[model samples]
Target: SLPAAAIHRGAPGPSVPESPGAAAAAGSLFRPLSAEDGEQRPAEIESLCMNCFRNGVTRLLLTRIPFFKEIIVSSFACDSCSWSNTEIQSAGRIQEQGVRYTLAITSRQDMNREVVKTDCATARIPELDFEIPAFTQKGVLTTIEGIIDRAVAGLEQDQPIRRVTDEEVASKIDEFIGKLKQLKEVHSPFTFIIDDPSGNSFVENPHAPQKDDALVVTHYRRTPQQAAMLGLEVMGSCCSVVSPLHVLQFNTNCPECNAPANTNMKLVQIPHFKEVIIMATNCDSCGHRTNEVKSGGAIEPQGTRITLQITDPSDMTRDILKSETCSVEIPELEFELGMGALGGKFTTLEGLLKDIRDLVERNPFTLGDSSTPGKTEKLQEFIGKLNEIIEGKTKAHFIMDDPAGNSYLQNVYAPEEDPELKVERYERTFEQNEDLGLNDMKTEGYESEGASGR
Candidate 1:
């Protein structure tokens, strides 16, 4: 039997206003839940067993959260299967924008601060190269120490770390874990970042900061890519059509032909890099096909450059994911791949060369009666050189310059000992950032060379 005041079936109730303190707190904000009868309700429903198909009773408790607003806490238990589950949902309207919280943990006191993380939040400790992606765990009301412990647990179960056979690498990981545990008691400084595209996460901010200091909270509009990843409506005329498995499809005109073409875009999450939207387009009328890759995350503060040499045939198999803002260059051949020249693509070095070869073969500058003998000879020579590189008959350098830091080159089994393959990363210039849309062109910023303070 439930309380009569607690059960409200289908009626309009008075709206409960939020408190000032609740609105100021850097935690979850929610409005009170009321039914048409002016009373809150706790609904009960059937819960199906995940392992076995047995059904059990699920009780949903709707109540006002202490110091917050209202939330629904649901619990379920199966007597036959001995299974249990619990979940929480905020009784508030969805926020229009996402939030990013950055806290610099300098003292043990900072480690004990409360943290409220939603299921849509992604936590990252950049100093340790550790990350917990969205939906890794349910929303949790825990302290900073608890978050670190969860990260440690996730790292222990990581398949890639477990697959590493190098004794030194394994020892390094163990040392990192030990250091993370020590941060709870020790005063080691580190940065803790939580990004939530759903705008449902929060960090307990008891006292408001007066000056620019450690704990910095910033709210940013979700990029089109990030919005798509979170299954939110994009802010544009393009209507997103939901397909199977959360894929988004939309209609677009083919660049080669005027016919209508269907573009399929999906969000791809990479380990080290940020989320990316992979779009594949095809036109049946003109046989035009194109694949484009765009970063679905924030613009990186710094840029990245990857340089690799193709010495053997096996090097051609190395994977490369180039973002639309990235440019490719082969210094040895005096060939440069400008931005948007071939569009963004995810392919092997061999496949990329093949694509370039095909582009050269199809270019009007190389073929047709308008071409001269010298131009034709030069094009043929370049094609021959590309073929040589593909066949491992000659060596060539592959350079990728990405100001957005979204491009990636496989480095798991890379020959770091070889001097031929050089990889370097440096800060991008203000102009470069402006060109990449990272900063406004009119904004004033300090100019720098290869490495200098901004």
Candidate 2:
């Protein structure tokens, strides 16, 4: 599979939104190229064509998409056989996480949107129940229509042979091909998905710098198998892997009963964004088990405040990555989980709420002479309200304020706006910086400072 390409270099160009209204939404981002822009020649290299064993030329264009990163698009053509090929390669390094792009195709205009399918990317049409496996046909830089056309061509190519040998299978193939062809007309809406472990695939959005209702993009941590595919994971010594992904175990005392225990500490990468160290301890004497998550990176420069409105029970299933320095707040329930209350956690929204209830009930201050009947009743009422939110019986806003900017709250409705979610990033206040001990930290000129002060 050598990471080959499927885009035909002979394509005049990608289909663009032609309707005036669609063009308006596209703005300068998707505007047609001017003569001056077309005058610029791309870099070229002459090479042997694998098809005809004749000399061919490959042209490379380096361009940056609006509201997106830079990329290189290469087109190759062999004059002898008139064979053409096109490929797209990401100019940036491998991202921290793999990405999944889901696009809802409901109209002809939608089919014109450009797509980048890397060699390691898998494309699927859920409505058709058909999938294009990675490296099956090579990477491609084409439009939604282009991908479907390619599928149609591949299916029809095998029908002739099937009709001669296996008429039964051939008839089924013909029927399936007919259904795939109808999709081109978009008689019914269908989902187009591209899951790329390399995080190199892309689906264009005419409405750039704004949310697209029909598209959703989610970032996910790569599994060991996926990492191995990308050459990021290797066998041999456990230490062969990079930091924040290694396992370390040591002896420790159990917190529950002060008994001897062995704590398993593994610094692992989390799906939300970064790496976190997870510690689990077991006490054989008391049969006690406990696990905890701890931050493994330095404090972020800016602070993050994420607000998610819980309007549906399904929202409870949303993933939440709460860093050690984050605080959870529910104004409607008049409840707040202060910083360091639950330490660091990677769990679902409902799970976090449940933990909050348990932590409050177990608060040492809730016991002794300080605990009054009135206080107990109030606490019980609050817990009940928390349960309602978790059950989606009541609507509420879940807020996480992290001065370290490492926390994350999943948006089930992504690549599009989730009316229920709003996020804001702000500079940390002086007091907040002091609390995180960032004021005393020196990141820049440390060598010079050491030389001078020492």
138-173, model 1: which lDDT tens digit per residue?
Answer: 766567887888777766765365547666776777
Could you give candidate 2's per-residue lDDT for residues 1-454 as a string of tens digits? 1112322432222223347565346432222222345443555789989989999998765544321233556788988999877776655446546778889999988997767788788999987789999878766667788898888889898787899999999999899989988988998899999999887777865542124679877655577799888878545555443355466778986554345689888877755467767788888866878777766676677999999878889999998888767888888865666565566787899888888877666442242123457656766777778888888899998899998888888877775777899989899998778666667766799799889998
For all candidates in order, the CA lDDT equals: 0.66, 0.72
Q: What TM-score should be assigned to candidate 2?
A: 0.46
TM-score for each of the candidates: 0.42, 0.46
The C-alpha stretches of model 2 lying farther than 4 A from their native spots are 1-40, 48-53, 61-70, 234-454
Q: For model 1, what is the C-alpha lDDT against the true structure?
A: 0.66
Residue 50 lDDT in candidate 2: 91
In candidate 1, residue 445 scores what lDDT?
39
Itemize residue pairs with steric clashes in candidate 1.
Answer: 11-36, 12-36
